[model samples]
Target: MPRWTHYGSVEELMSNPLQHLCDISKKAQQHSITQNGMEEAMDYLHKLHIGDTLVTSTWKTLFAAYRAELAKLFNRIGVTLDITSNELPFGRQDLTTPIHSEILTHFLSTSEDRLDLSSSNLGTPRLHRTVASPKPLLVDLTSTLSNLKTYSRVIRIAPEKQQFTYAQHNHIVSKILSSRPTPTLLPKMETLLIAPVTDLTPLDGVLSLHTIFDQSKQHMLKFARDPNADEDTSKSETFDPVETADKLGVNAITFQILQSKRNKLLKFEWKRVMSDVRDPGVFVSYLYARLCGCVLFLSSSLSMI
Candidate 1:
């Protein structure tokens, strides 16, 4: 059995008030259906001329994961799904369908009247779909700061990734850039990167974003080197997570040692990291650009004076 409204179509229902026929589906009214009933409903659903828009009843938490997959499947096939709340603690019945401007106005007005009536009793106010539990101020602040740091770091490091491979690099750059209308312009290389940023342990894990970016660069480089590399060989070349973690740990230790002795050991500064060898010039420029800028600036000042 399917839920039927007094209005024939979604458009007509949206234009008019919500009027569901109580007798059509007992399960729909109750917001819980048996497995057999669900199968039958799905069969009936497939038979109907479903278009771009779809509406679905939310299932129990036990079926939540599968229900989400079902929603995704609908989306993949170009259907826009409107999910209604589940049975026990019932949610808004009227908002089961996507609300239009008129429907929104009606709901708001109805809520206002309810609030006005409930005002006499301060113990409980009219709770509605529009209201949500207040989030903790600390939680919100921490989340904002974390996101800001991660995104800021990503933006700062984007140019380095961009210099590696144009196509793949642009994909990452575009995603980070699109988060805001205007992005903070990274200062000239001369001002930044004055010190060797040898300690870059990702905030997340061993397989951090920088590692992923480097992996993509290496992948692009491999394709450039041997365009005829078989798909099988390419698949075989995939880095093992455990092995990568081990190597990253080793690199971190080695970088620490090198950074400590960089002033005394000029040759070590020129030496490239074993993990990455392509375009050592970029690292050298990043590590020493500020020194070059300082020397040039001092020389110019002396010459001008």
Candidate 2:
């Protein structure tokens, strides 16, 4: 008798829509399920069929991370974090949809504050090939639950047919994200929206205002930490490649060092100043000028020699 260890059973794999969605891949399609098989697996999940325990293990893991990140982003931007739902429901109910609208609403925004839903074009009907399609807003409640990581997983699994087209995914995600009610501030009303970037790495499109600010702050701090950086350019020689190039009338400078070793030097002229290279900072501006001057003097001396 041969002992057999089964991985995921067909029914077991099919029960979890997110897992199935994540498993979608050309290889998976070829080896286990076809493209249509995956599609059928996904279509089996309808919002109506969803029970109280609609959230999946995948949802629990990913949503936890998502909420944590969002909380940090909100905190950084001076926004209060309010989550009404402490526990997300999950189970063996075999719901086709990954999550329900109620759960999505909880995830989106649970506050009573209502923005004029009228301003939102969610009321707009989707058109398909000159015929109006069903209200995607009504059907796409679960769409916003996916993120770049999950999308990447989907692509990794099945590249051909996806539940949502790139544009469709973005659009649905954008709608769900933007549906969150804006906090009302007395005297002045302000809103912050984080745009999702298509770039797979570094949470490209999903970066919040605070995340961007924090990144910029870190970059500035990194530069600040360097003692020999712009702040202390006393030792740095100034070399305005542009001016030197103009004076020499060439894009590149190729010359031999006047020392006995006779080292050859070939370098391109620096056409852009530091300020031009990056956004202007007081220290950078001054340091760049000093560096340019040093370079020019060096070039002039070398030319004379």
Candidate 3:
């Protein structure tokens, strides 16, 4: 049951290398053989005629010609075949030989009139298999003013309230910065150290301090700005400070304090929370000693009392 496209001689095989391969593939199918098995059979046949110099020379020529035609066909279709592997070039390695044979048969049987040569059909031009790496996410302090301006447009506040908010924001930010041992170095620091409000007793008010911190942390992390993002894109990506402030039920100064601290805060990872230190309080104390050298205070009252 070997299906044969019987070429009279090596000359006929060299003349129609693709057709000969197709015929061999069909013959391989009858024996329930794979592409790899078919390749071995072809190599065995080649070795049988190796003693005859003319036949050997003709086979080398035929193989070279077959490879060239395959390359040309793939190039025309905008595919770069990995011809180094003995497997079919068009599809995945897991695909059966029969599927590969069908692909080849369909491609070869297609008429010129039926073939679509449009860019959409051919797909976009791609570089030689190079994948782009993702951009790093970093804070863009430069866009802070622009972000504030965007925040202003989304909320309706009186001129006096707006001015007071700005003053309050600045004052809290100044206190937070000034409290740091190296106050000048805080602005230059690339990343913020954020921790959960473990000691929530101090700020407990109408709303739980822990709840407010968690909400603010979630909001801050959700819209964390990319330093490299374009201006137009950043403009559209708004994190309304007013809305965040309202949610926390904080006044202008407290809202500013949270905003300033939140900006410097890094995304907290649970994996990193576990430490070798015997006491968690000791770790917190160490961080405080290293960063601020003093306890940062917060008041529940909106009006400074």
Candidate 4:
């Protein structure tokens, strides 16, 4: 527009309201920045969401109320409140970087009072595989944490894996049951037997020895007489399909056994077996026989394949 109508006058007219709005906006921006910084720091300390700003903002007021209540109780009990000190009895300390470093160094010291590494088997080579009770420990820890709402964030740092196999799990349960003095009850023991249908390898031989201990009634009798014998030795002589199936508690084992059979079949050398076969009919018959033998060896089915 022509003549740019009195720019100084226009600025003067809007100055008061504009300045007020500008001041409000600046204050709001600063508040937002401070709130965000506080939230970030809190999250770092607690390792979990602290919830809404409205809720969190009231915590300081709530804490003050609690402190006042405690002070009143102390006064009623004839204990004088320290008016000079604003700090609570168990208040968190404000430490400098160097102080924090020193505290951490003291905590991590290898001295006996700070850290103890001695154990009966500390230097011994581990002969058996060690299965940790991480899941049970986590469950116990979770139970303890459930009592404290603020400490619920610690669950995220716990281990997820149980680290024990089915047999090991059963053994642990049995051990726990045996250790209990009251009621004098014994836990039902079960065994897992995994056998390959192929020729006996060294591992298979070892497993055969295990099976002898697990399945032989004579060995079980010997174990009963000799307390020093393997505790895992089973009392049964023959594998009773009905009783065994009932104890198994899972139908998935059947599927697993079938899958194992399929794997063996897939790995079988067809060329090696059928190389001498000249006739297609004879080859088919021979393959059928081999498959039947494998099926019998792998499964308990008595029907003709």
Residues 1-305, model 3: lDDT tens digits: 12232423343333223444545545555667764565554554343221111111122233333333333222332333332223221222222234333433433343431223322223222221222641111111111212222211111112222222334434433433343343333442112212122222322122223333444444334434442243333344443332222222222224433333223222222122223232223222222111110011122111221
lDDT of 4 by residue, 90-174 (tens): 1123223332223224323333322112222112222112234322221222233323323100001012111224343333223
Model 1 regions lying over 4 Å from their true place = 1-33, 49-58, 61-305
lDDT, residue 120, candidate 1: 32
Better of 3 and 4 by lDDT: 3
Model 2 lDDT, residue 78, Cα: 32
- Write down the lDDT of every candidate, Cα atoms only: 0.26, 0.26, 0.30, 0.25
On TM-score, the candidate that comes out on top is: 2
TM-score of each: 0.17, 0.19, 0.18, 0.15
Q: Tell me how candidate 1 scores on lDDT.
A: 0.26
- Candidate 4 versus the native: TM-score? 0.15
Please list the Cα RMSD from the true structure of every candidate, rounded to 1 decimal place: 26.0, 25.0, 30.3, 29.1
| Model 4: CA > 4 A from native | 1-164, 188-305
Candidate 1 residue lDDT tens string, 194-225: 11232333332122233333443343344335
TM-score result, candidate 3: 0.18
* lDDT (Cα, tens digit) per residue for candidate 2, span 118-162: 223112222111223433221232222221122111001111111
Cα error, residue 174 of model 1, in Å, equals 16
Q: Alpha-carbon error at 269 in model 2, in Å?
A: 27
